[model samples]
Target: MSVAIVGVAECDLGQTGKSVLELQTQAVTRALADAGIPLSEVDGLATNGISRFSATQLADYLGIRPAWSDSTFAGGAVFEMYVARAAQAIEAGQCGTVVISYASNQRTARSRKMTGVFEEGTPEADFEEPYRPLYPISYYAMVAQRYLHTYGLGRADLAEVAVAARAKAQLNPAAWTYGKGPLTVDEVLEAPMISSPLGKLDCCLVTDGGGAIVLTSQSRGVEVLGYGESLTHTGMATAPDLLRTGAVDSGRRAFARAGLTPDEIDVVQLYDSFTISVPLGMEALGFAGAGEGLYADKPHNTGGGGLACCHPGQLGVLLLVEAVRQLRGSGGERQVPNARTALVHGTGGIFSSHATVILGVS
Candidate 1:
């Protein structure tokens, strides 16, 4: 009944000009190879960003008939949720080996645009879509504004997060902003504004990339020690508290299930869709006190994260890839010292969806 991540990998990062299916194939095959398991042995598949029938389409393209498949779409949090589901299926004897993956050509195809998180005839459409505000960003920006105002913090306080992420990316050769030189607080503050306090530098990299992770109950690698997920709302219009999110609930459940606490985790890989996401995630996960995570230095986002690293639409799957590498002690120059356990948190859809996964050596 124990589930473990046997292998994890990412395909061509940056602008690959490849289709989503092509990127998905590359990531999946490479991950399978890493696990020393052939594609024929993969009877489970979980993926999205391909088509409406995400899992079904990828299964046919890979020429495999999976006994179990999942295509849950909740933005970046989907992959972590998929890991939870895949582990359950393996434990239930529904599938033996599961391959969870995701890929996006948002940068190459220039399709990373947002009107709203709602469809026609929905409450969001009637109430929030008429103003023509850029969603996701605008929603997060509103939260950022509220958070800063609530705590009497300034924009300079958030700039530290971007500077720190860029520094970490410098240590990771695979990061998009690696070797781009060191970033300064002033530079981040001076960057062109995207949505109020969040400037261009405060955002994540837009790139073409994909990643995958292979899981099994054989216990050959990092174990899925704990997991949790939550959906507070679909759109920001109905969101109750702009500063508080479901990450608190998800992270608490994960820690309680893992029999561990934030202090025990040696490494962290929270989805950094924007600079604000990091501090907010830290506070939500109890790594720091209320309104204090922004300045708290912790072992987090060693591979630059979505800010300096390649962000292919959804960054959840890649978070697992980075965490696995760190846990395996294969982090090279960016390897954390005496690292044993790692925590990964992903947020999606303007902080509407959340997932937290705790990983440790099997």
Candidate 2:
């Protein structure tokens, strides 16, 4: 049996002010429609959050009677993990169709602050919290600073990442930043500084949205060739090296499992929580050498990614949706020409957790 992503959809992006459940249900409905299936056919469900009963809660709200369910919380990489779990469930006869969904109202319901949320007794609280990094931008800024210093790169290198994403967004009508016009590297460099070496343009947009995917054992759609995940550290303070994220190990495992290589990927959808993350991920994923990972000339993040598309907390699900679109030749104006293979990567926490999924036409 082979697992295939049969359906993929994303809810409206940016400032919807909808409840998390509303966003999730809308995405689920859209996904089911795309798959030409009904809720009754879905026997497995997966999501992520701090809530202990989220799986049951979602299953009940969606009126699903899932025989298998998972609520695995791994920050942004949760949805990729869900895809892996859904495949296992389908292969083992535990389920036939599995739906993986994600939703967050972070922009509308909460402050953008990324501090003091971790458990009080955890390493984040003991070491990272004391530093008062304030928001994710600040933490990522520290990493950006280190990366630039170590590699002899400058802020201009990072600016290109933002510029490329914005350029891609211009072609994506659904992107949150669509119609904002393309951004130039100089403009990105001049954008207000959020933190040292990182300006507002380098950061991702905060939005409220949801996305879902339906997977089946029969290979009737884009096949999930391989998947991999890794966790290096939970806190920025505890990370072995800020410049080296877990994407290296995860990407290696995914490519090996898929029997592919960096050069074989036709499109790349690396998580871009910050402009700096793009280069970091590229290097880790073997797309480029150290200090040379800025993909100004490569085909990547064609839907603009989190930077210009939408970032509603966990973005792995959206990345998967975009990859599916590209693989199916339905990416519209932003579609990569004859895209046959895609590498979708997601990062969680500061640089802690990582997940990679390789998808190809069936």
Candidate 3:
């Protein structure tokens, strides 16, 4: 049986002052409605495992009696992993229809402190967290600095990534930064530096949003051509190579399974936790040669990505929503011309984990 993404929807982007649960329910409901499938048909559910009993709590709140459920936690890439798992379940006859959702109130709740350093007794606490090297921006900054040094690239190269994302956001009215104005490379370079090479614009916004995707056995909508995931390391400090990420292995697996090449992808939706991640992902995904990733110059993150759109803690679901819209030719002004295939890549845990999915109009 072939699995397909039948529906994708995102809750209102930006700050909405809504609870995480409320956003999750709204997104799931909207996705179900978009799929034209009744809630009763949803036999499987998947979501983040942040909460100890999140799966059961969500199932009960939505009044669902799912036969199978997954609350796997892999950071921002969790949703992509969920989609891959849902497909496997359907193929194995463990479930029929599955729904994957994500919601976060990082902006409204101001939960930055919750993510501070690792737990007191964890391995990271002893060797990494004490130095504060694992904080989100700081970790990414370290990676950025290494990438820049290795590739002989400077802040200007990174600025292009932010500029491109903002340009795309200008075409997406729903984007959080849309209509505010387009971002210039100079402006991005001149912005306050959050961490050495990463200016304020280099980081993604902490917005509140939720998204959901529905998958089914019938390959009617955007078909799932292939999916792959990899976990190279748990923390940046432990990574064997700073410039290389799990995307290399995951993208290789996905493209091989789909029998497609990087050039064949009509659009790309890569997790943009920071500006440097784009070029690194491009290179790792085979879209660009090593040290030449910044010059790939392809249409990426068409919905502005987390950079100019909304990050909301986790963003894999939103990436799928945008990719589906592009494939459906419903991406409004941000639509890629004649888009037929899209490759969405999600990263987690300071470039430790990765999930890649290839989608095409069926």
Clashes of each: 0, 0, 0
Local distance difference test, each candidate: 0.90, 0.87, 0.88
The candidate maximizing lDDT is 1
Question: Which 10-residue window in model 3 sums to the lowest lDDT?
Answer: 111-120
Query: How do these models rank on lDDT, best leading?
Result: 1, 3, 2
Better of 1 and 3 by TM-score: 1
TM-score of model 3 (CA atoms): 0.96
Model 2 misplaced stretches (Cα beyond 4 Å): 113-117
Model 3 RMSD, rounded to 1 decimal: 1.5
- Model 1 TM-score is 0.97
- Across 1-362, the per-residue lDDT of candidate 2 in tens digits comes to 78999999998778888888888898999999999998999999998642567789889998889999998777788788788888888999999999999888788886454333466688567877777775567889999999999988899888888888888999998889999888998998888987898998999888888799999977689899999999998777788988888999999999998999999899989889999899998899988888888843457899999999999877899999999999999989888999999999988888788999999995
Which residue runs of candidate 3 sit more than 4 Å off their true CA positions? 113-117
lDDT of 1 by residue, 1-362 (tens): 78999999999899888999999999999999999999999999999887779899999999999999999788999899998999899999999999999998889999885333457788876877887667668777888888899899999999899999899999988888889999999999999999998899888889999899999998679999999988898777889888889999999999998999998999999999988898889999989998998976779999999999889989999999999999999999999987889999989998899999999984
lDDT of 3 by residue, 1-362 (tens): 78999998997778888888899988999999999999999999998733767788899989999999998778878788887889999999999999999888788887744343245676655777667653778889999999899878899989999998888899998899999887899999999988888999999988989799999998588998898999987666578989889999999999998889999999999999999999999999988899887888777899999999999888999999999999999998778899999999999878988999999985
